[model samples]
Target: MDAPGRARREARIATFVGLASLASAMGIGRFAFTPLFPLMQDSAGITLAQASWIASANYLGYLVGAVASYVAAVKAPLAARWGLVVVAASTLLTAFADTVARWVVLRLVAGAASAFVLIGASAWALALLARSQRLRWSGWVFAGVGVGICLAGLTALVVASVGASARWAWVGLGVLAAAVAALGWRAFATMDAAVRPARPRGLGALDAASWTLILCYGIFGFGYILPATFIPAVARAIVADPRVFAWAWPLFGFAAAVSTIAVSHLARHAKPGAAAGCSFIVMALGVFLPAVGTGLGTLCLSAICVGGSFMVATMACLQQAQRVAGDASGGLIAAMTAAFALGQAVGPLTVTAAAPLREAIARPSAVAAALLLVAGIALLWCEGRTARK
Candidate 1:
């Protein structure tokens, strides 16, 4: 092959590595439990409150890992390698966890590992693709998260049909993650040359508008997590059959993947903040659907709306940070990430508190939708602030 052909081939490999890495880390390590939680509840008689604690533990660990990744000088490939290993180990170990305490610890470890894997693998893959001028392939890399989610949800649907225990489902996911890690292990080798980022020009570029965007990003996290964490459970309440309710998550994941591609086109016509604000409005509608409407149709529509819009908000928020903060965007972006993680941690706890209510999902969904609507309006104001300045 010619030199150019060789670079393109290497870039393609990098894309696959990134996709598989994120699938294992995010889809399995971070979100597999969401799909499997109902099974765990059935098998172990775990209460919704206990599940909330477990989910919050994972989110808290993700916050810690995000901060560590930002401050540390670790090499990309090394972070990617060990992160994936830990994610697989933590997931597999959860199979033997007999108590809520062990579940919390294992999930915490898995969450932190997922964060590191995301940062490291994304950095490594994007760098390689940029070098080869195949950066467009990066979209497929991120879509892996949704693909993995769909895959996990489908796997759970299958496992439930076969009457396999939740432990067996965990074992299956752990093995699958390990398999992908091993397959893509060599692709990260070429990324060893990547270096730590340079010192920033400081937070001088951050203005009121930037801070508002950060807050809005956090709100987006809180709004989406309610559905992302418990949509399966909610669907089950309406439809006891796994074959029927299990499809909710797969639809959510599919919409997530499609939205990623859709957002790029959206950017061509509107500012990132404007586009993201519209996403929040759509997500607010999604969040409210299940609250007011009944049956599988409304629940599934909610899943599609919430899942489809969160990534748009995420991508747009970071892009807006870069635009508004210029050379100082790194720290600003990190702040937004931490804020988002904190919001996610708070979400399930809110659910746990509402678990005692006569109508848990509707009340919380109402509150979440209200918050989202307020934030959506705030983002539009922030967008205009930039224009006025």
Candidate 2:
């Protein structure tokens, strides 16, 4: 192959590696618990409150990991390698966790690993692709999260059909994650050498627009997570049969994957803030659907809307931040990620605090909807202002 052909091949490899890393980190490590929550409650005698806490613990760890990515001097490749390993280990070990406390600790560790992998792998892959002038394929990297989600959801569906315990499901996910990590390990071998360390910056260094972006990202976190975390459980509550309800999460994942690619194409012409605002509006509608309409159709629509927009909104916001912040995008990205993590951590607690779990769903949904609307308005206003300037 010629030099250009080799560079393209390397770029494609990096994108695939980034995708697999995210699938292992976010899909298996961070979100596998969402689908399994109901199973743990049914088979393991775990309470809703305990499950909420477990989820919160994982989000908290995500926040810590986001912070650590900025402050720590760890190399991105090293972090991605270790993070993937830890995610596989933590996911595998969850099968052996007999108690809620054990699951919480394991989830916390998994969350941190996920954050490390996401931030590290994304940076490494994007840098490689940009250097190779293959930046257009960056969307393929983010699609991995949705693909992973789809795989996990499908695995859960199969496990549920087989009448296997959630333990077996976790084991299956762990094995799959390990395989992904091993395959992606070679892609990161030269990443650490290729990328230079980012210079540190103060919190106040970001301009007004960046701060607004961070706040909007936090709201995005709070807005989408309520549905993202509970959709499977909500579906289970509506339909007792696992086979029937299992489609919700995989549908959600499919929508997410498709939307990310679509939105990436749209973003070339449309303003990122406007695109993100539209996504937030759609997601808000999705979050409000289950509250008002309890039917299967409504649930499916809700899944499509929320899942479709969350990753797209994330890509838009991160891309916008990078464009605006230029060379100093690292600190801004970490700050936005930390804010997002904080929002995610708070979402589950709000649901748990509301009594009579079924009734409680509406309140959080309403709040999420309201937050998303506000965020959408804010982004639109920002876009308009930018246009006028």
Candidate 3:
């Protein structure tokens, strides 16, 4: 192959490696707890609050890991590899813990480890790829999270179907994560040894506007995740056919894949603001349709729209943060990621909290969907202002 062809080929190969490993580390393991929540609650005999804390632990760990990994990447990409291995180990440990308390701790450890691996791999990719190609390539790399989500979701579907055998699902995910970690280690080693410039710490680029975006993104995180996590359960509650619930997640996975591609394409023409606005619009429609409409058809449509739009929104938010903050984009991205993590962590908990209201008025799922619509509107407004300015 010609030099250009060889470089392109190598970058593509490295990107796939980075994405798959990242999906295992960050996407599947970190978010898997959501779909497993109702199952784990039953199996572990835990209160909603306790289960919520376990979810929170993972997010808190992700926040810590993101910052730590950012620092570690500057010195060596191997830091990411170690982080992935640790997270995978923690995931396996979760399977051994019989008590809610122990599982929470394990999830925290897993979250931190996954964060370090994801942030480090992403930062390394950003630094290594040429500037002209970074945006699109980085989006593709980030798609690993979606890929992992699909895997975890599909696993949850299968495990949930087995009645009481769902514990094995956690073990399966841990093993999958570990395998991905091994693959990531090999890929990181193969890539050119390039070091990142020093990052100014202490929330480097965060400003008032950036903080607003973070809050908005947090809302998006919470809104998107509630549906993503519990759509299967919702399907079970509403659908006549129980098996239809099992299919919700795989559909979500497929939608996520499509959305990743769509968002990347949109980025080529529309600025981040336009992209965010478009995504939020789609998400709003998705959330409302399922809330007001009926049957599996609407449910699947909601999943497809929500899955695609939110993923794109996240990418657009990060892109906007990078554009607005320049050198400080790293910190801005980190903060937004933290916010996003916080939202996902809180989403299921919010559902549990709202459970009591189900008897009094509308269903909890409807309430959650309404909240998502509100968040989408907020995101659209924010993006519009950003574009105008």
Please give the lDDT score at residue 348 for candidate 3. 60
- Write one digit per residue (lDDT tens) for candidate 3, span 102-156: 8878888888877666556765665555432545776677677778878887787
In candidate 1, the residue pairs with backbone N, CA or C atoms under 3 Å apart (3 or more residues apart, or in different chains) clash, namely none
Query: Per-candidate TM vs. native?
Result: 0.89, 0.96, 0.83
Q: Which numbered prediction scores highest in lDDT against the true structure?
A: 2
- What TM-score should be assigned to candidate 1? 0.89
lDDT of 2 by residue, 9-50 (tens): 889888889888988998998899888877777788877788
Q: How far is candidate 3 from the true structure (C-alpha RMSD, Å)?
A: 3.6
Q: Best TM-score goes to which candidate?
A: 2
Q: What is the lDDT of candidate 1?
A: 0.79
Error of 1 at 65 (Å): 1.0
Residue 42 CA error for candidate 3 (Å)? 5.6
> Per-residue lDDT for 240 in model 3?
31
Residue 338 miss distance in model 3 (angstroms): 2.0
C-alpha-based local distance difference test score of model 2 = 0.85
- Give a tens-digit lDDT track for model 1, residues 1-389: 99999887888888888888988988888888888888887888878888889988998877776666666645667778888999989989999999999999999999888877876776677667767877556567777788888888988898888888889989989999898778767767644525343233345655777679778878887888888888888887788888887888889888877786666654445787887888899999998887788778888899999888876676567557656765445456656766777888888887745453225767778888999999998888778877798
Clashes per model (N, Cα, C within 3 A):
0, 0, 0
